[model samples]
Target: MTSSSRRVVVAINPAASFGLGSEVGPALVTTLRGLGHEVTSLTEPDFAQLLDATRAALREKPDALVVGGGDGMVNLGVTALEGTRIPLGIVPSGTGNDMARGLSIPIGDTEAAITALTAALHRPPRVIDAGRIAFDGGRARFACILAAGFDALVNERANRMRWPRGRSRYTIALLIELARLRPIEYRLTLDGVEHVERALLVAVANNLSFGGGMKVAPDASLDDGLFDVVLVRPLGRLAFLRIYPRVFAGTHVTDSRVVVHRAREVRIEAAGVVAYADGERIAPLPVDIHMQEGSLRVLA
Candidate 1:
């Protein structure tokens, strides 16, 4: 899999890394070029244009596509390279590097992360599953988690606020959302079997973590041909507050109110609820999702 001169396309979210970390994009490009790779670096003003530029670059059939950002950028990669054999590489420089964490790629340290990308390029790309989301307007792919519940609300709220940058924004959002928390009623069909449940949130996870290192589905696997359907039943504010901190260590899954199920295909419905996958707002439920085995090839 190693090449003396590989072509790489790098698309970065300029807003990534809280505005200070955009330098990682140029760092990656420089390092990649130093390694004897032909790199096409693209930095766009917004997500749509970034995705469009990435797609256009991907159309060139480069040796690889390296995106410098968080899981949202990973989502862009899957959307652009869906059904293609091209392997995607990640250079984490965002608020929540859950995707990179799940793949064991270094975070924060640009040098270490780029080193990992370079090493992965020299070996056979790892094959992983992607969750394909089908909602009104369109269908997209998620390489990490797709959640609809209280967490998604927090995501929406956080996106609206501009103060207190970095992970603290999400923390503040979570606190604000928790103050107004109410269990959502959900009708879920897993592998064609249906059930109704009331819970704080329902997360369909392909990777292990989300919302920054919260191991929402600690037992989940990226390559598994199934999704871990996690349901957190209604809890009092006190209980929820206590359990929230445990999610970082992934111990929240063991709580009695928490339940996990496995399915290859899922249909989730909750009136007035919006879903977010890989930290990007997807759509209002109900959305149909299924695990596509080995759908994505990643340079991890």
Candidate 2:
């Protein structure tokens, strides 16, 4: 069947991008229906409600599930759609639609994204790897990158801020966290081999970028079946700040302070460090992350 005649369920986070969902959600429904596809548009009160609604929608067996939000919405969609055959569609309308950016989905332009997604859905869904995280009691899956140590701290702080809206909130939160940067004691076991170090940041990447297009792992590939584990060793405040700009251009991978490794399964443990992936907090450190090859099917 052609994509235009298929059934689609669009789940939107009303709070995404601080409120973009309120408009984007209705637009998606209208667009999808206008294309002659049957669309179910959902706007939930919160993340849990969104997840539950999307999960329920999946049981109806729609041709695809399109998310109209950011990376966090994609992460939630992945958690609900993983191991299933339905293709995931993205409309980037959030603070950091890095997953959309990494997947080459048009960012910030909802019409362009919808056009791209509609075209992509006409073909086979592109298979991509996803990171499965296992912690003390529970587990979760992330579609983009998993971050620990200093980056996670920044995410924690950014999520707590009320003033200074938009990206400036994150910048302020990053500065606040940067002022207190310190080496974290890390014990990492990658593919059964153990290594310990004092690192400032550790990122396990499936796609190439995160945090609104910061190319923390420039050489990462979503279908490679391996993770690009980028580690930044402890650096003084001035040097660390100097390397910050390089991350936006993804040049930090070549720096002397950065180390890159490839592994299928990794066990990470860092004292007092939390883990954040796709702009959502997963859990504290001591989580085992593994690359699940071809686990995600993206319409992009």
lDDT digits (tens) for residues 154-227 of candidate 2: 87888889988778988898899889989999999999999998899999999889878899999998899999
Q: Which ten residues in a row have the lowest lDDT in candidate 2?
A: 14-23
User: What is the lDDT, from 0 to 100, of the residue 51 in candidate 1?
Assistant: 86
lDDT for each candidate structure: 0.90, 0.88
**Over 4 Å off in model 1, which ranges?**
1-3, 162-169
What's model 2's TM-score?
0.95
- Give candidate 1's error at residue 54 in angstroms: 1.1
Give the winner by lDDT.
Answer: 1
lDDT of 2 at 219: 92
Cα lDDT tens digits, model 1, 1-300, are 244778889888757645757689889999998888999989888999888888888889998999888888888988998979999999998878899999999988989999999989878999999988999999888989999999899988998899988679988999999999999999999999998999998999999999789999999998879999999999999999999899999999889999999999999999989999998899999899978899899998
Measured against the true structure, the TM-scores of the candidates, in listed sequence, are 0.95, 0.95
